[model samples]
Target: MAVSQSSVFSESARGDAALSQINITPLIDVMLVLLIIFMVISPVVGLNLDARLPQANREATAPTVPPLQLVAQADGRYRLDGVVHGLDTLRSALVQSAANDPERVLMVSASADADYQAFANALATAEASGIRQIAHGQ
Candidate 1:
């Protein structure tokens, strides 16, 4: 029998030990599973909010009643519809007006020499009285 090196040792046993190619099938499978899970869950996570959109109407009518007018005077007084009112009475009057016509507009006119505190008070009163639309005028 002829004994040779090829017969005695295999290719890996020949001491030519170099690094082999890495097996990446398991890593690729894990990544693909994660991608699929995210794809399935993304839409469900984004659909959390439910909202009703407003409809557009062609025949929206303007308010028939005139707007409520409040003027701030220099002496810390407020005038509503040309009637001077104290701070306490102004709140009650504004509340009554808002209750009477919920859709009515409020126009606040502050004079050049008016007190800033008075102007702010009148604005706050109107808002607290549930007047939804308030405007500033010259």
Candidate 2:
């Protein structure tokens, strides 16, 4: 005897639109990877702020326009022309100096062992104060 198969799947044949649905698995994976990357990098950022300074010669010809000297010591003290100034007042004082002489320039320098980041910060702060002519080194 032969058996007959039933036609149970012969209706309208419609189902959920699987093709149009979004797959979030890849999205989640990418997001997780990015999260881990950010976690690893967040702590390392802004930590290495010290700059390595270069050697200066005592017998170099000076430029026609003098540059106001700013120094950062290894101990984190900031000096404006060898006079110590607090970090809080440094920016404002530089601004005032720039305002008095709009064409003012500054020489940014620090010891080799000093925090380079501090020197860079000082330079940025001075530039922000509108010192028109800025230079680095002695």
Judging by lDDT against the true structure, name the best candidate: 1
Candidate 1: residue pairs that collide: none
lDDT of 1 by residue, 50-133 (tens): 788998875896647878889989988889999999889999999999889888889998889987898999999889988899
Candidate 2 deviant stretches above 4 angstroms: 1-65
Over 4 Å off in model 1, which ranges? Answer: 1-63
Worst 10 residues of 2 by lDDT: 6-15
lDDT of 2 by residue, 1-138 (tens): 554344334322333455558899999999999999999999999588879899888679555666689887788767887788767788888888888877767888887788878887787888787888888875
* Model 1 per-residue lDDT at 85: 92
* Cα displacement (Å) at residue 125, model 2: 1.0
